[model samples]
Target: MSENRAFFRETVEQILADTLDQSRIEASERRMLPAALYKALEENGVTRMLVPEGKGGIGADIGDSFAILRAMGAAAAPGPIVETMLGNKLLAEAGLEPADGLIALAFADDGAAVLHAVPWGGGVDHVLAVTPSGISLSASASWEMEAALDAADEPRDTLRGSLGAIVALDTSATLRTAAILRAGQMLGAIEWTLARSIDYAGERKQFGREISKFQVIQQMLAELAAQLLASAGIAEAAADAGRETLIAAARSRLGDAADAAIGIGHQVHGAMGFSKEYALNHRTRRLMAWRDDFGSVQFWRRRLAGGFVTCSREEFWPAIADAGNRRAA
Candidate 1:
């Protein structure tokens, strides 16, 4: 890793370690994020890492930002940090001021249809509509609550928007950006699940011995480790390449890893994991939410298939070659 990247990762780890209060995460599971927790993130520069130095930020790169996102996911802490950072960049790109207070993003596929899946809609002060077409800058004050969960208890709500008001942002590139970040989040989640499961297996006695000594438990961990490593590699590769197909592929793999990690993690923890008190739920629940946040494995799989279907068999090989060459450059 680059020295800067190592430094960035260390800083993010420190900030999360110090500020990620378990009570705060548990509270966010039932209600909106606590204001004090948000303030801690902002004060620690977690919220402004991506903002340019000229714009009162530390001007961190996307790699550094990914490190933070992964750390947050691993901790299963609550906030709109990713959404806020992405929104700020989008607004700056279109020559507008950033939104104040908590920010969230909602997806819009149709230019004229109102999007209903505005994340954290109930508590967010402002939300921007993200579509394959463009991004909206107009702030919506009134949000009708339609609470939904993608398997996690974190707040998710619905809202509508006028697409015409949005600027014509690069939708393809934007999707890649979101996919990469989501992949990073998944990586963190899987890492936590695998590591936690191993620790639990070692501590939990079964058949008059530590479960970690059993072949079954060891096998599960090996599989989990393989999945985690694969997901991590895919996330890093997607970031390094910055290609839509690569990002979609990474998302697909990472989503699969999230599923396996969560399942194996809970299984290892047994009844305790299913209960409301265990810390295992916090991280696994976030993985559940993240798997479908940007695009699930199925969603990205279709996207990846479409890319191949559009290209003739004769052209497919050359396209792959060209993409590899571009990455090598």
Candidate 2:
């Protein structure tokens, strides 16, 4: 089983290596969907990765889904891969077959459904209207995407047209699933940022010595490495346990890693990191944007606080310890 997982991981890595070239990243950043790359993901079964094979899908578990998400994050594959995977899972949960083509979160505002900061919203054929009432699938109201600054530049669009059909499912489940997926994506972002930072630090010289040799630079790298490991652990635990609190913690931890790693990444890259032409921004911008994607740090922090409030003073330490014990195991 482990070997199978390893092979899948390598296969994903190779696919991203071949598909997410510099040209595609730039085009995606410009809010344009790389049609070929999107089709490649579909052909490889990633579009239906989370759905069961019996349902005309791949039937991949959360672990496999997350692995693919992380690879996309690392490669800066821009589109609705995450949205499509989670949306398909939710639809399957409701025993509803998702409409073909890409899918995105359908944000609710009053009576209308809207999508804000939607990745590749313009590129998708369907906008998933996940509301408190139920889950509704709407055809792309309009591909007329509004503007966004984050170079991942996933076109954000609003839903104006009438909804087709809706399903009954807990809204929290969708949020938790999306949040967990975002956390996994952060793992890839942090890793990609660290890889770039280390490479730059080792190559760029200061005072006839590589920047990587400096104690300050080394310390920052070490801190990012430690945080990345913790972030990965939190994400894995949340995926395994399905605890809302753990999921929130994973998102919070990911936000923390984004804060630190984004700083260290740009610091090592100097001015070039922020330059529009540089590849570092492709990964780093997404990290920064995703920190607040599903839920910001403050939001998750409040969610965690609510969870802890249930425990009495006497049970506090035990509760915390038990959670840690479970994570360790």
lDDT of 2 by residue, 169-225 (tens): 777567777888877788898999998899999999999999999999999999999
Q: Report the Cα lDDT for residue 63, model 2.
A: 74
Candidate 2 lDDT (Cα, whole model)? 0.76
Model 1 / residue 320 / CA error / Å: 5.3
lDDT of 1 at 62: 71
Candidate 1 per-residue lDDT, tens place, 261-329, comes to: 988998888899997778888888888878877776788878766666666889978866654233211
TM-score of model number 2: 0.92
- After superposition, the stretches of candidate 1 with alpha carbons farther than 4 Å from their true spots are 109-113, 131-133, 160-164, 310-329
Q: For model 1, name the residue pairs that clash.
A: none
TM, every model = 0.89, 0.92
Candidate achieving the largest TM-score: 2
Error of 2 at 185 (Å): 1.3
lDDT of each: 0.74, 0.76
